[model samples]
Target: MIEQPRHIKSIPAYKPGKSSVDGWDGPVHKLSSNENPYSPLPSVIEAMSHAVATMHRYPNMAAPELTSLLAQRYAVDEHEIAFGGGSVEVAAQLIRAFAGAGDEVMYAWRSFEAYPILVRGAGAEPVQVPLTPKLRHDLPAMLAAITPRTRVIFICTPNNPTGPAVGHDELRDFLTNVPERILVVIDEAYGHFQTDPSAARGIDLFREFVNVAVLHTFSKAYGLAGLRLGYAIAREHIQEGLRKVAMPFAVTDIAQAAGVASLAAEDELMERINVLVAERSRVEIDLAIQGWNVTPSQANFTWLELGDATDAVSAHLNSRGIIARPFSGEGIRVTIGDAAANDAVIAALADAPRPSA
Candidate 1:
C-alpha cells in the first residue's frame, strides 16, 4: 500500500459555494462566493476577447506588462511584485516558500479557511489563535503564539465569515513585536471594499515592514473573479522565494490583459465597489434592526453570528433562493450582491426566527 501522511489524509477539503439547491428550481442568488454583482467592464471584456485569439501560444511566463502596470500603480519596484492564478495560489506558494515539516504557521481561528489548510498541506503545524470577544483578530494573542518554530503568520483583515477588521495601530504594534526574520503575510483580498479609515492597509504595511508580504486579488472589487488573477508584494528575498515556488505561467494571457484593463478603469471600478460597500453597510444595519447580531463588516460580505442556529438560518435563506455560506454551528456569511439579491437576503432574515446562540 502506498503510504500517506496522517495529516494529509485528515485534512478537510476546501468547500466552494453551492450553485444549486435541492427541491428548488428558482433563480438562485449566489451570495456564497462573495463575488461582485457587476459584470466585467467593457474595456476589460474587449481586452480579454483580444487575448483569446492568442490561445494557441503559451502565456508570458513573467507577465511583464501586467506586472509593470501594477508596479507603476502601487509605486513598487517590479521585483517586489509576483503574480499568480489568484491570491489563494499565491498564498499557498508563500506557505511552501517559508515553511515546511515541523515548522509552524499561525493565524486567527475562523479566518480565510485556507490558512490552516495551506499550512498543514505544507507539512507545518497550524497555530490558530481565537478571535477576541468582539470577533476581531486577537493580534496580541497571535503575537504571543509565535515561537522559534513559527515561520509564517497570516493576517486577514476584515476577516472572512466574521466581518470585523483589525485596526491599524493594533497591527503596527503587533508587527513591531514580532521578530524581523519571521514572515507575516497580510491577505487583503477584499481591501477595495474597505470603508473604515483605520483598517490596516496591507500595501502601506508591505512598504513599511521588510518581513511583510501583501496579497491582493483582481477577483474581488475588480469583478474579475473568472479571470483568476492576483499578485503579492513583498521584500526582495521574500519575493524571490514566492517567484521560485510559483507555478510558471499560472496567470494566463487573458487574465493579465483583463487585470491591466481593470486597473486602468479604476475610477469606474471604485464606484462599483463603493456601491457594494454601501449595500453591506445597509445590510448590517438592517440585520441589527431585525434583532440579528451582525458583525460590522468592511468587506463586500457581512457575517451573522448565529451560533447554534447557524444551520437553520442557512436553510431558511436557501429555501428563499438566497445561497449563503454557513459554518455549521458557528455562523453564516452573506455576500452583498445586486439589489435584488440584497433584497432577497434581507427578506429572508426578516422572516427568520431570532437565532438562538
Candidate 2:
C-alpha cells in the first residue's frame, strides 16, 4: 500500500453545478453553471473552424498574437501577461509559484470554491476569512488575518455563490496596509457582467499596486467556457513567476484564434451581455416584489440566502426542470438564463414554501 500526503488526501474534490435532473423528461434549463445562454459569435466560430487545419501541429506556446492583442486592449506591457487553462488554473499556478509547505494562502470563504483546493494542492495552509452577513468580502478582517507565513490572498469580485463586489476606495485602502511581499490576486472571472459604477476594476488596481495580479476568463461574457482560456495581468516579475510554473502549451491554437475573434467582435458580444444584464435586473426586482430578500447582484447571477431551507428550495427547483446551483445549508444561486428560463425560476420560487421565521 502506498501512502499519500495528508493535505492531498484531505482536499475535497471540486463539485461543479449539476447538468441534469432525475425523473424529468421535460425541457431542462441549466442555470447551475453560470454560463452564457448564447453560443459563440459567428466570427469566433469561423476563426476556430479555420484553426482546425493546424491541429496536426503543436500550438505556439507563447501565443504571440493573442498576447499582443490582450496587451494592447488592457494597456499592459506584453511581458506582464500569462495564459492558463482557466482563471482557476492561473490561480493554481500562482499558489504553486509563491507558496509551499507551511506557507498560508488567504481568501474569503463562500467565495470561489476552487481557492482552498488549489492552495491545499500546493501543500499550503488555507486561511479562510468569513464574509459579512450581507455576503460581501470583509477586507479589514482579511487584512487582520495576514501573518508572517501569509503568501497569497485572493479577492473574488462580484463574488461567486453570492453576488456583491468590493468598492474601489475600500480595496485601495486595504492594499495600502497589506505587506508588499504578499501576492494579492483579484479574480475577475465575472467582472464583465458587473453593472456597478463603484466596483473596483482589478486592472486599475493592478496598475496602482505592485503586489496585485488580476485574473480574467473568456468563459463568462465571451462565451468561451468550453474552450478554457483565461489570462492574468500583473507586474513583469509576477507574470514571469506564473509563466515559469505554467503547463507547457496549456492553451491551444483554437482557443487563441477564438480569443482574437472575440475581441474583434466585442461590440456584438456586449450587446448580448446587455440583454442578460437586463434580465438579471428583472429577476431581482420580481423576486423582491414577491418578498424574497435577494442580494443585489452586479454579476449575471442572484443569490438567495435561504439558510436551512436551502435543500427544500433546491429540490423544488429540480422538480421544475430548473437546475440552479445550491450550497446545501447556505443558499441557492440562480444564474440569469434566457427569458423562458428566468421565467421558470421566478415561477418556481413563487410556488416554493417560505422558510419559517
Candidate 3:
C-alpha cells in the first residue's frame, strides 16, 4: 500500500454546497453558494458564442488580452496581473508559492472557510485568529498572532460566511505594522457588491503596498460564476512567482472572452448590484423585526446568527425547497438571490414557527 504524507492525512477537504441531490423532487432555490442571481451580461453571452467556433484551438496561455484589460482597468502594470481558474485557485497558488513546512499563515477564523484548507494543503501551519464580536476580522489579534515564521496573511474583506469587512484605516494601520517580507492577500471576491465607502479596496492597497496581493473574481457581481474566471493583482515580482506556479492555460478561452466582455458591461452590472444591495437591506430589516440576529453584510449574502436554532432553521428552510449554507453550530449563511428567490427565503422563515417567549 502507498503511504500518504502525514499532512494529507490530517487535512480536511473543503465542502462546497451541493448543486443537486438525488430523490429531491421540489424546486430547490440555492441560496447556499453566493452566486449572482442576475443573468450574465449580454456582451459576455455574445463573446462566449463567438469563442465557441474556435474551441479546436488551444487557449492563449498568457491570457494577454484579458490581463491587459484588467491592468488598464485597475491602473496597474500588466505584469502585476495573474489569471487562475478561480480566486480559490489563486489563493492556493499564493499559499503554495510563498508558504511551506514550518511556515505560518495567519487569517481570521471562519473568514473564508478555504484559508486553512489551502494553507494546510501547502504544508504550512495555519494561525486562525478569532473574529471579533461584531463578526469583523480582528486585525489586531491577527497581527499579534504573526511571528517571524509567518509567510502569508489572508484578509477576506467583507469576509465570507460572516459578512462584515475590515475598514480602510484599520487595514492601513495593520499593513503598516506588518513586516514587508510577509505576503498579505486581500481576497476581494465579493468586492463589487460593497456599498460602504469606508471599506478597504484591495486593488488600491496593492498599488501602495509591494507585499500585498489582491484577488478578484468574475463569479459574483459580474455574473460569470460558471465560467470560473479570477485574477490577482500584486507587485510584479509576486505576480511572476505566482504565474510560475499557476497551471498553464488555466483560464479557458471562453472564460477569457467572457471576462473581457463583462469588464465592458460594468455599468449595467453595477445597477443590478444596487438592486441586490437594496434587497439585502430589506431582508436584514425584516429578519430583525422577526427577532433574528442578522449581521450587516456588504456582500451578496447575510449571516444569520440563529444560535442553537441554526439546525432547526436550516432544516425548516430546506424542507420548504430552500437551501442555505449552515456552518455547523455557528449560524446559517443565506445568499442574496433574485426578487422571487429572496422573497421565498424570507417567507420560509416567516412561515416557520417562532420560539416560545
Candidate 4:
C-alpha cells in the first residue's frame, strides 16, 4: 500500500445518515440527516432554474453576490464574511488556515464528529473535552484543556448529537479566560431552531470578542442541504485567512443563486421552522413519557442516550422505516421530520421495546 500521513490515515470519515426506506417496501420517513422536511421555496426553485442556464460559465469564485447579500443581512462588512461548500468545509478551512503540525485544535467530544477528523487532517493535534452529564459543553473544563499550542476551539451551540446549547453566561465567562490569540468558532448550524432564551447568540459573542467567529449555513434552515452553502463571520484578519484557504470555485452558481433566493424567502422558511420547533417539543415530551433518557432538545432533532441498546433500537427504527443517526453503543439522534413522519416515529417507538440504559 502507498504510504499515507499518520494523522490522515487515522482520521475517521464522516458518516452520513442512511435513508430509512432504503430496503423497505413502504413509504419511508427519513429522520436521519437533520434536513429541512419542506421542499425549496417557490422563489428558490425559480432562482435555481434561472441559474442553470449559466452552468457553462465558471461560478464566481469570489462569491461576490452571495457575500454581499449575507453582509447586508447581517449588517456587517463584506470583507468579514467567508463561505465554502458548507459549515463543515468552512470548519476545515479554519483549521487549515490557523492550525498546523505541532499546534492543537480543541472542541467538546461528541459534539460534532467532524471536529477531530478535520483537525487531525490538517496535521494539528485535537484536544477533546468531554461534555457534561446533561450533554452540554463543560465550559470550565474546556478552558482548562487550553495550552500554548491551542490555536483554535470549536463551540457547537445547541451542540449536535446532544441538543442542549451552551449558556450565554458560561460562554461569556469562558471567552474571557481564552487567550485572544486563539480563534473560537461558534458552530451554529442549527441555531434557527433554538428556543432557549439563555442560549448564546454567536453574533453577540462575535461583537464582544475579536477572536470569535460565527458559522452559519443555508443547508439546515433554508432547505438547501444539497446546495452545500455556508459562511463564517470573523474579524477582518481571520476572515482573510479563511478566504486564503478556501477551495476555489467550491460553491456552485446554482447554490449561490439559491442562497440569495432563500434569504429573500426567510419569512416563509421561518414559519416552517416554527413548526419543526413545536414538533421537537412534542418529540421530547413523547420520548420522556416513553421512558427514554431524552436530553432536552433545543435543535431540530432529539437525542436519546440509549446506552447499550443503541444498535438494536436503531435497527428497530430502520425496520419501521424511520431512518435515524445512531452511534453504536452511545445514542441515537432522530431528526424531527414532517407531521406524518413524526407521528410514525412516536407510534413505532411506542410499539417497540423501550431502550435499556
**Residue lDDT tens for model 2, 13-113:** 99888999999988899998899999999899999999999999999988899999999999999999899897788999999999999999999989989
Weakest 10 consecutive residues, lDDT, candidate 2? 348-357
Global local distance difference test of model 2:
0.93
TM-score of the candidate numbered 1? Answer: 0.98
Candidate 4, residue 53: how far the Cα is off, in Å = 1.0
Extract clashing residue pairs from model 3. none
**Clashes within 3 Å, all models in order:** 0, 0, 0, 0
CA lDDT of each prediction against the hidden true structure? 0.89, 0.93, 0.88, 0.91
Cα error of candidate 3 at position 20, Å? 4.3
Candidates 1 and 2 compared: the better one by TM-score is 2
Write down the TM-score for model 2: 0.99
lDDT (Cα, tens digit) per residue for candidate 3, span 1-357: 998798777788788875653455777888889988888877889999999999998899788889899888888888888889999999899999999999999999888878888888889999999999889999989888989999999999989988987898899999999999999999999998898999998877887789999999999989888888988899988987897789887888999999888888888888999999999998899888877778999899999876667788888888878888988667899999888888888888986745433
RMSD after CA superposition, every candidate? 1.1, 0.8, 1.6, 1.2
Ranking by TM-score: 2, 1, 4, 3
Clashing pairs in 1: none
Backbone steric clashes in candidate 3, count: 0
